[model samples]
Target chain A: MTVTSLPHDAALSARHPGELGLRESATFDRATIADIQRAAATGVYDIRGWGAKRSVPHFDDLLFLGASMSRYPLEGYRERCDTDIVLGDRHASKPLHLQTPVTIAGMSFGALSANAKEALGRGASEVGTSTTTGDGGMTPEERGQSKHLVYQYLPSRYGMNPDDLRKADAIEIVLGQGAKPGGGGMLLGQKITERVAGMRTLPVGIDQRSASRHPDWTGPDDLEIKIGELREITDWKKPIYVKVGASRPYYDTALAVKSGADVIVVDGMQGGTAATQQVFIENVGIPTLAAIPQAVQALQELGVHRKVQLIVSGGIRTGADVAKAMALGADAVAIGTAALIALGDNDPRYAAEYAALGSAAGYYDDFQDGRDPAGISTQDPELSSRLDPVAGGRRIANYLRVLTMEAQTIARACGKSHLRNLEPEDLVALTIEAAAMARVPLAGTSWIPGAR
Target chain B: MVTLIGTETPAYVPAASGATATLVDLAESTVRDLNQALHEPHVQGEWTVTNSDGKHSIAVGIDAPVSVTIEGHVGYYAAGMHQKGDVIIRGNAGVGLAENIMSGTVHVTGDASQSAAATGHGGLVVIDGNAGARCGISMKGVDIVVGGSIGHMSAFMAQAGRLVVCGDAGDALGDSIYEARIYVKGTVASLGADCVEKPMGGEHLEELGQLLAAAGRTEQPSEFKRYGSARNLYHFHVDNSTAY
Candidate 1:
C-alpha cells in the first residue's frame, strides 16, 4: 500500500528507539483491544467462578488524605491505629472481639486441604483476628487452633451442632457469598477423599452438593426463628452475623437487621470461591464499591451504625484499598485471595512447576483440582507440604501488620484521630467508574451526580 | 398433679409454675422418680404411648435405657440429645427428630419432617413414612432407615453413617454427603454436587439387609439402590467444573 518510505534516520529522528518506539507507542482503546482479542482467539476457554481477569475500573481511582487537616498523624512505629473490631451488639453476651480488622473468610475443609485450613486459622490467630470454618463442617483441629473462630451456619447444615455453636466466638449465617450468589457449594468427586468425605459425612469419592436454602426456614421471618434457635443453642452468648452477597445489598442488609443479625458481612463481586458456575460468579453480583455505600446507608437508616458492625470484603489488595474501604464506611475488611497470596500463592519460585502443569505463576487458576503449588487449595499430601504452617502464618501476620500500618498512615493524613474518622469527604474519585460506584466527587471538582 | 380427664388425653400442658419445660422434662422427672423409688442402679423398661400430638423436644437428653412411646404426631427435635434411650414415636415427627442423639434408638411410626435424626451419633433412627429434607444430616455414627420417600438433600454432608430409604429421593440427595452409605428404593431425582449413583452389589445388599433389620424393616433388600461419591472434584482442577 505504501509507494514511498522515509529514510530510517528521518523516520527515527523524532524519537529514540528506547522511548515511544514500538513497545511504548502501542496504544489501543478498549474497543481495539477487544477486536484484537476476538480475532486472536481460536476457541473458547471454559473457566468457572467470578472476577475479571483483565483490568477493570476499580476503587484505585480513589485516594486518601495523609496527615494534614483536622487529623493528627500517628507515628508509623510508635503511635497506634487500633485494629480491634467488636462484632455484634450489646445483646450478645460474648461478642466477637478481634485484635485486627483483617479476619479470615470461610474456606471449607473439603474445598481446601486440612493443613491449609489449619494454616489459615493459625495465621489469623497469630495476627489477632478470627478464622472461619466453611460448609463442610467444623473440625476440632480448626476450632482448637484458631484463637477466635467464627462457625458458619450454611444452607446445607453440614457439621452444625450446638456444642460447636457454643464453643464458637461468633456465628455467621451464610445467606450467600459474593462469588456465587444464589448458588450452593460444590465439591466434585475427585476432591472427596476418604478424609475429606468423612469430614463431610458423605461417601468417599462422590460429588458433594450444598443446598441453596436452609432446611428449617424459607423466608426472613423464618430466618428470625433460626437465629432464635441458634441463640437458644448458645444461650445468647455468641454474636450472630449474617453474611450476604453484594446483589441487592441495601435490602439484604436491612432484612438481616430485621432478622436480628448483630453483624453484617457484605461480600461483593470480586470475592473468590473454591468452585462455582463461571456465569454465576462473574454476572450475579455488584462490585464492592457500590455495595459498601449502600450497606452503610442501610445501617445508618436503621440508626444502628457502628452498633451492628459492617464487614466488607471483595478484591481488597493493598493498605490503601483497606483505608479506602474503611473511609467508605466499612468497620472492617475480610480478605480471601490476598490472604492466600500472603500464604504463598503464585510465588515466583514455583514458576517452573506451574509452567510444567500448563499454568503460569500468576495464572494458576486450578483451585478446584486440589493440586495447588501454594498448598492453600489442595488436599494432596505432597503439595500441601510445600506450605509450612508456622512460617506461612508469620508471613500473613506480617502482611496484615503492613496493611494496618498503611491504613493508619492514610487515616492520620486525613486529619482523623482514628481510622473510622477517615470519612468519605476526605477522598475523591479520579475516574467516572469509581466516582459513580463509590459515590464520591470527581477529583478537583465538587460535583457528586446524585448528591443533593 | 395434673390428671388425664378422658381416654383421649391432651397432647401437652404448660407447667403450672410457667416454666419453659418440654415433654422431655416430664419424662425425665417420671423416670428419675421411678429410679429413685426402685433404688436400682440401673433399670431397663419399654413404655409405649398410643397418641402423640405435636410435642417439641420430647425425650430430650435422656441418659437411661428407657423406651419412650408416642402414639401420634410429634414436633421438633423429638428425642433430642438422647443417650442410651429407646424412643418410639407412633406417628410423624417434626424437624430434627432425635437430633444429636448419642447411642439411642428412635422409631417413627409415621413420616418425619426435615432434618430427621440430624447430627445423631451412634443411634438407630427408623422412620416408617416419608422423611423430609436433610434426613440424617451430619450424622456421625447413627444409622437411619426410612420406609418411605425422602425429600431434597437428604443425608447432606453426613460425616459417617448409613441412611436407608425405601422410596424415591428428591434432588441433591446426599449432597456433600461424606463416607455415609445411602440406599434408596426408587429413583433419585438428582444426585448432589459431587455424589453419583453406584452399583449395589452383594456386599452393599448385605449391609443394607443389616441396616433394614436393625430398623425393624426386614423387607427385600434388593429393592434398594446405592449412591456414593465419584471422587473427581475433590481438588481444584481446571477441567473439573462439570462435576461442580
Candidate 2:
C-alpha cells in the first residue's frame, strides 16, 4: 500500500506532475476519487447547480462557409441582415415579436434572488426580448420589470394565480429541463426564506420538493386536453408553449405539436439547473447540437417547420451558438447559464469571496448552498442587494447586443438576408462525430458521416 | 351525427341579463364557441348548456359573475380555472373537475373522474358523488367537500385548504399533505408517508361544520376524523429515506 504523494510545498513550487515522473490515470481520475470519497462519507449524492460538466461535441465543432468565388456577400455594415423573429404566431393572436432571436430561459426566483430576476426581466425588456417566470410562480418585481413575461405552468403550481395567468403574455408548460429530465425541482431549506416559503405555500425554512409528474395530467394524450383547458382559460389569446428535455426530440416535438402547442422549446443536456442530483444532470438528455435536427425533422414531417416555432436551449453562449442553432433549423435560442454569466455570476471580481467559501470564481457550482458571493443566486438581503438590477440589466442588454451583432455578421458573410435563411449547406463539421450529429458534411470533403 | 338540439346563435352577445337565460347547445355549436360566449366581458345572468354528452371543457374559464348549469354529462376540466362564477354540473364529470379554480363555486352533482379540484388557489368545490383518484390534490386555499367516498391519493400534497369527505377514503389518504386539513367521516384505507391522524379539536370541528354547511351537507362534524402533516419529512435527512 505504497502511495506516491506530491511534495509538501509542490503546489507553491515550480515542480509539475509530469516533471516528477508521475502520470494521472484518466479512468481513476482525481475528481472521480474525490467524488467516491464524498459519497462514502456523506451517504448522499452530490446535489448542485450548473449543467453537465463533461465534454460533448457542441456548436464549436461546426464551421460556417462565407460567400466565396461563386456566391455573393451582403455588406457587413450597411446591408440589412434581419435578426427579428416572431414566436407562437400559429395560434396565438398576440405572438412575441422580438428584435433578436435570443431570449432568456425560465429561471426560478427561489434559485435566484429577486434582484436577479428583476435584472433579467429588465435586460430582456431593454432588448425587446422575452423573459420567463419559473416554479415559484410570477413575482411582482419580475412582472413589473419584464415587458413580455411568460408564466411557466409547472407541476408544483406554487404561487399560481388566475390573475397572474391573465397578466402573462404567454404560457409555457414545462415537462422537463435538460439538467434532470425525470427529476423535480429542489430548493433546500437554507434558500427557503419566509418570502419563498409564503410563495411556495410551505413551512418556513423547509426543503421543498416539487413533484415531477403533473398532478392532473399524465402523458401526451392527457396533455392535449390540458392544453385545450389552458386555451379556454386564457380565451385562445396567449400562445401555449410545450417545453421538454431533449431526449426523444422527434417524438417529443411531434407530440407537442399534436398536443396543440404553438411553440416548442427543446432544452439539451448542457442546460443548467438551480439544484439537482449530479448524476441526473450528467446522465440524462442529449446535447444541443444533436437535438436540433431531430426536432426540425419532426416539424418538417408535419409540414409545420417554422410555423410552429422551435426555441433551442441549453449551453447557448455566443452569437455563433445562436447562429448555429438557427442554421440547424431552430426558430430561436434561449440562454440560461449564459444569461446568469451576463448577470455577473462567477465573475472574477468576486474571487476573494468565492475563495473564502471554498470555491473559486469560475469553479463555484454550489448554488444550492445559497451563499453565492456574486449575490445573483442567493436570497439573503445583504447578498442580493450587492447586485443593482439596473446595472445588471445594462450588462445583459450589452451581451445580447453582442450576440445578435455577431450572428448578423455571420449571416451577412453567408449572403443570407435573414438569420432564418442560414442553412446546413453553409455549415461544415470539423469532426466526424460532429458531422454525424449535426447531419452536415465534414470539412474539405463532400461526405456527411452518418448520411453517407 | 352532429344534430342541432337548439337554434345556434352568435358566440358572444352583449350584456343582457334577463329572466330568460342564455341557452347553449353543445350539439348545435362547438366547445370553443361556448367558451367564447362565456368569456364575453359584459356577460351577465345565467347560462344553460344542453346536449353535453361527455363533452370536455364544458363551461370552462368563466370569469364574469354569472351562473352556468350543464344539463348532461361533461368531460375533463369542467368549470376549470373558475373565478367569479357559479357552475353546476347535473351529471358526471370527467378528469380535473374545477382544476385551478381561483374563486366562485363549482358543484358536480354526479361522480367525478381523477384530480377533481387539483391545484385550486381559492374557491369551493362540492362533489356530491364519489370522486376518483387524486381528488383535491395540491389544493391551495380551496375548500373541497365530497359527499361520497374519494379514491386513492386523494388530497395528496394538498397545500392549504379544508377537504371534508363525508364517506370512506381510499388508499394513501392525505399523502404528504401540507397545511391543508382533511376531515373524513368514514374509514380510511391507509395513511401515506408523513401523514398522520390528529385529534379533532373544537376549532377543527367548527371549521369542519362550517365547510359542511357551506357545501350544503348534513354530516355531523363529530363523526369525522382529522388528518394532517406530521412535519417530520419537511426537511431533508437520511433517516427519512424510507418515507421519501
For model 1 chain B, the run of ten residues with the poorest summed lDDT: B1-10
Q: Least accurate stretch of 10 residues (summed lDDT) in model 2 chain A?
A: A1-10
Per-residue CA lDDT of candidate 2, range B1-244, in tens? 2233443332333335224467787878889888888887798776788889998888788888988888889999999889888998989999999998989999999999999999998889999999999999999888999999999999999889889999999999888888899999999999888889999899999999899999999989999999999988888777787888
Model 2 regions more than 4 Å off: A1-14, B1-19
lDDT of 1 by residue, B74-110 (tens): 7676676566767778778988787776787888888
Best by lDDT: 2
lDDT of 2 by residue, A245-330 (tens): 99999999999999999999999999999999899999999998999999999999999999999999999999999999999999
Task: Give me candidate 1's interface root-mean-square deviation.
Answer: 6.4
lDDT per residue for candidate 1 within A1-452, as digits (tens), equals 22134445655657754543333324775545754685457232333422545454567888765556665666665665666778876468888778777788888887777777888888888878989989887888898789999999887666665557667899999999988779888777767778886666566776566777665556787677566556644556789999998999899999999989999999988888887755577678888888998999999999988988899988889888888998999898988888888888888899988898777888776677677777778788888888888787788788888887788777766656567767898889888778877888888887766766
The estimated TM-scores of all candidates read 0.76, 0.95
lDDT of the candidates, in the order given:
0.75, 0.90
What's the C-alpha lDDT at position B41 in model 2?
78
